[model samples]
Target: MATLLAGMGVVAVTNAEAAAGCKVVYSVPSQWQGGFTGNVAVTNLGDPVSGWRLTWAFPSGQTVTQAWNATVTTSGSQVTATNASYNANIATNGTVSFGFNGSWTGSNTAPTSFALNGVTCTGGTATTTTTTTTTPPPTDDAMAATAAMQPGWNLGNSLDATGSDETSWGNPRVTAALLDNIRAQGFNSIRIPVTWGQHQGPAPGYTIDPAYMARVKEVVDWALADGFYVMVNIHHDSWQWIANMPADRAGVLARYNAAWTQIATTFRDSSPKLVLESVNEPQFSNSSGAAQNAELLHELNTSFHGIVRRSGGANATRLLVLPTLHTSADQARIDELTTTLTALKDPRIIATVHFYGYWPFSVNVAGGTRFDAVAQKDLTDSFDRVHDSLVAKGIPVIIGEYGLLGFDRHTGTIQQGEKLKFFEFLGHYARAKKITTMLWDNGQHFGRTSFQWSDPELFAQIKSSWTTRSGTASSDQVFSARSSAITDKSLTLNLNGTSFLGLRHGTTDLVRGTDYTVTGDQLTITASAITRLSGSRAYGTNATLSARFSQGVPWRINLITHDTPVLQNATGTTSAFAIPTAFRGDQLATMEAKYADGSNAGPHNWTSYKEFDRAFAPNYTTNVTTLTSDFFAEVADGARVTLTFHYWSGAKVTYHVTRTGTSVTGTTS
Candidate 1:
C-alpha cells in the first residue's frame, strides 16, 4: 500500500489523493553543546490521508540519534521519515506528530523547507505556526490549581516507606539544597508521600506521633518555602493488617479519620500551595469484582473527603485529591472514583491515579529493550480515557506517581535509549492532555545529597517535555474499532480515520467511493458496493466480517456465543484467545459471549481453558513482544454471525495472524 512517487521523494498510495496544505511545525525543544531534541507535527489541511511520508533536509550537520512516533531514515543531510503504523491514518484537519534527539558537530541550524507526500507545507521553515490558544479549563479552583502543577517530582521511599525515619528507607535526609535543585530542573510541584499508619498509635483513636508529624511538616515547609506546590498524602498504610483487611474495616475507618484529622489540622494554616491527598493506593479485595471493590473504595474516599472538609482554615479552599481504587488506570476504576467524587459537588476536589501503566517499563520488572509502538498506543489510549472521562468534566487528573522505575533499577541492563524514549513520550503526552505528571523517584536514580541524577539523558528529556509547550510531540492517534451492524446504505464507525477500515472478500482491497463513501472512521456503503458484494456473495448472513485496528496496537476480539458446540459440547476449542502475558488476570471482557445456539457459558475462558494451548505466553520482561495465539477461532464451525463479536484492549501485536474459514474475509482500517 506504500509506494514512492514516480518523480518525487513522496511516498504514498498512487490511487490516494495528494493532499495540499500539509503544514509541519518544527521545534527544537532543547539544545545543548552537541545534542538537541526536536519535535515535528504534520497537519493535514486538505482531504484525509490513509498514510503520510515527510521529507526534509537538515541545514546544519545535525544527525538524529533517536526518534519516536515515526520511523526515520537519514541519508547525509536529507531525511525521509514515514509515519508509524499507529499514526499513518490522519483525518482531514487532524494532526500527527513525532520527535527525535539529534546530535550536531559544529554548527546547528534548523531546516528551511519541508514536504509531505511531495506537497510543500505552509509552515515548513524553522519558525512554527501558532495554533489556537489553549484556553485553560473553566476557572474551577481545583482545575486552576492542578493546571499550574505540571511535571512534578515525588519524594518517594524516603517518607512513604515502612520506617518513620527518612534515612531508614535508604534515601538521604531531606535538604533545602535538594529542593532548590529540583525547582531549577523545571518541577513546579513536589508530592511528599508519608506513611502515617507506621508512625501512628494503635486502636480506635489512632493518633500520629507528634515528632513524626513534625518531620512530615518539615519536608512540606521546605517545598512550600521554595514556592513549590507541595502535596502530602497518607502513603502505604494499606500494607498493614488493620488498613486493608475486611475484618478490620471499623478499626481502619477510625484510624483513617484520626490520621487525616491530625494531618489536615496541621496544614490547615499553611498556604494554598499545600495540597492534601487522602491516601496512597488503598488495597483490599472483594469476591464481587471491581464494581464491589469500587463500592468499598467509595466509602473510604467519602471518609477521607469528609474528614478533610471538617478541617478549617486554608484547608477548606485548598485542593484535595482523592485517589482511584488502587490508583488503577482501568476506566471502570476511574469512573467509580469520578462518579462518586463528582456527586459530592466539591469544586476544590481533584482526582489522582498512578501511572505504572505497563509495569515492565514503569516498574523495575523485566520487559522489552525499546518503548515500541505498542507501549506508545497503551500510553495514549489509557491517559486519553482519563481526559475524556474526568478532565473534560471539570475534574482535573494527576498522574501522581509515574516513571520508568525499571530503568533506574536495571540501569546497565536496560537500554538508555529506551529510557529516554519513555520519558519523552510520557512527558509530551501528558503536556498535550494538560494532565499533571510527576516522576516517582525513591532515591534510586536521583541523589538527594549531590542533586544529581544517575541518568542525565533521562532527566534532560523530562525537562524538555516540561519546558517546551509550543512544539512538544503529541501522542499518536488511537482509535478502538467498535462494531455496528451493517445497515442498508451506511456503516457508521466511531471516529474519523486517514483510511477506510477496508472491506474485502478474501484478498482484494475494496475500491473507495466506488464500494463505499468513506469519511473518517465511518464508511457509508453505496448501493453499487452493496450490489457488488451481494453479487460476489462476499458479505451475507453466512459470511464472516472482521476488521483489524489499523492504528496504535493490533487487537481483534471474538465474542463467541455459548450455544456453539465449542462451548457447549466440544472439548478441543477455547474461549479466550490472545491474552497479554502482563495481564494479571484482569478480565478483558465483562460480558461473556453466548454460544452460537443462544446458550450462555461460564465467564472465565482463556486463562483457565487455553493455557496449555499456548507454548510461550508473551510478557513485557522477556520479549517486548506479547505471546499471541497461533489459533484465532475459539469456535470450530457454524458460528452464528450474531454471536461472535471482536473487541480489543491496548496491547502490542495482540493478533499477528487471524483464524478464518473459507467464508471469512474483512478489512483493516
Candidate 2:
C-alpha cells in the first residue's frame, strides 16, 4: 500500500501501478467576461480501483465556485476532485467526470498535467476536448426516437400521488383497457410518474418495496406491449426528500440514486421504447438561489446518467431525459440544462420541461380571463427558447407535462372557449417547434372511471392539433341582445394556412351565399339566418354553429341571447354568502371588488378583479354567485364593498356587500 498526497488531501492506493495508466481531458465549454464552466474526465486505463482522486494545477488564478458529481476543493492554484460515494469505483478502462463553474481574470488556459493518486498521467495530456464521453457511445438516434413519440399523455395523480397507494388519488387504478383507450385516442407516448419515497425502506439501501417495483414494471411492460413510448420517473419525491439536498446532500443523493438504480435494473432489458427520466421537476429546498439549484439538479442528472448507462442491457443505449430546474422553460433554466447536456456529450440524452400556459392565465387570476396577446406571447416565448437553445442544436425536447393550472380545481375555471383556444394553440405551436407535448391529466380531462373525456370537444381540438393546424375565430360566442331585433353577426377567422370549408348546424349544412358568406378571413352570418336559427330568441345559447375547415377540428360558434343580469339582496354568515342573481341569458366572465375608498378588496388585493373561481364563483346551475370564506377573510369589518360582475355578453352588474364580524349582507343598491 502507498499513501498519495493529492492537493491538501491524502489517499491510500493499494496498488500504485493501478494509477500508472490514466488519461485526463480538461475542457472549458462556456465562458463569460469573468466566469466560465470547466469539465474534467478521468479515465483509469489500468487495474480497477475502489477509490481514486484526480488533481491538477491551474496555470492561471482560477477559483471554482460550484461543482457537481464529485467533491472538489481548491488550495492556491491546485484543484483536487474526489469521486462521490456512488461513483468511487472505476472498472478497468472506466471513466468518471465532474464539472464546475469557476471565475478567472485575464488569460484562461487548460491544465496540461494531471495526477491520479500521486501518479503522473501518461496515456494522454489534459487538453481542451470539445466533447467528453463518460459512458459507451450511444447506438441509436435519440432524436428520431423522440420525434416518433409525438403527442404524448401523462398518467398523472396516479402512481405519482402522495397517497398510500396508486388509487390513493381520485384516478382509478391504471388498467390495460385505459391504456388501450389512450392509444385509440391517438396518443403515441405515455409518461408514467411513480413515487418511491413512500414505498422505500430505511436509509443506506433505501430499498424500494418489491411489490411497488413489480407494479411499476407491470405498467411499463404493458405500455411497451402497446407500442407506446414510455417514460418513468421519480415524481413527487422532488418535494418529499430530494428537495432537501442542500440540507442533507449525502442522504438525498443516496436515496435518489438508489431509486433510479432499482428502476434502471428492473427495465434494463425492456423495450427501447421505454425512456428513463432522472427526476420529475427537480428542485432544491432552502437553496441559496437559482445558481445553487442548478448545481444540485446538475448533480442529480449526471449521477442518473452514469447509473443508467452502466446498468447494462438496453439501458446502456436507452434514451434518458433530463430536466432543467423545476422543469421550467425560462431562458436561464434552459441555458443551465444546455451546459449539462453538452458536458455529458451523450447523443442518447433528451431534454424535458413542463408548460402550463402563462402563470396568471394558467390559474385564471389577475384578469387573465382570455387567451389574449399576453398569453400567446408567453407560449411563443417559452417554445422559442426551448427550440433555439436545445432542439436547434441536435438535441430533442419533451414537454413532460402541459396543461392549464386551473384544470386542477375544475376545467370550468377557464371559460370553455378560452380553454379550447389554449389547447389548440399549444398543440400547433409544439408541433411546429418539433417538440413532443404530453398532456398532464390528473383525472380531470379524462374521466378515469367512466372511460370518457370530460370535455370531448376540447380533446378533439387537442387531437386535431397533432396532425394539422386548426382555424379559429376572434370569439367563440356571438352575443345577441334579447330585447332587440337580431342583426348580422361577423367573426374574423384565423385560417392558420387552411381554407375554410363552410358552416354547419347539426346535420344540415347552411347555404354559403344566403345563410353565411366568407370573404377573405371574415365570416358573416346573415340576420335572416340568425332569426331562423334562434327561434323565439330564447335566453342563453340559442344555437351552436360549427365552422368547418379543410383540415383539423372545426371551430364552434355559440349564438347567445342575453339581458343585463339582476342581483338580489341576501344575508348570510361570513363562511358563505350566496347573492341571488337572475343570469337571464348572460354568462359570468369575472368579478371585481373594491372598498368605499377605492382600495381593492378580496383575496388577491393587488388586482381589483379577483380570480374567477378562487375569490368568487358563479353557479349557473343555482343562478347565484357565491363569495367564499377566503374572500371575506380579507375584507374589512363593517366596510361596504362594491362588487362589479362582468358577463361574457358585455353586461356588468353592480352590487354592494358589507361584512360585520361573522355576518354579511348583500344589497343590489
Q: Which 10 consecutive positions of candidate 1 have the poorest summed lDDT?
A: 561-570
lDDT (10s digit) by residue, model 1, range 303-348: 8788777787877777888888788778888878977886788888
Model 1 alpha-carbon miss at residue 45, Å: 33
**Tens-digit lDDT string for candidate 2 (37-77):** 67788887777866788888988988887676578999999
Per-model TM-score versus the true fold: 0.51, 0.78
For model 1, the local distance difference test gives: 0.60
Indicate which candidate wins on TM-score.
2
Candidate 1, superposed: residue stretches over 4 Å from native = 1-140, 242-245, 286-288, 360-367, 469-669
Q: Among all windows of ten consecutive residues in candidate 2, which has the lowest summed lDDT?
A: 129-138
RMSD (Å) of each candidate, 1 decimal: 15.5, 25.0
lDDT of each: 0.60, 0.84
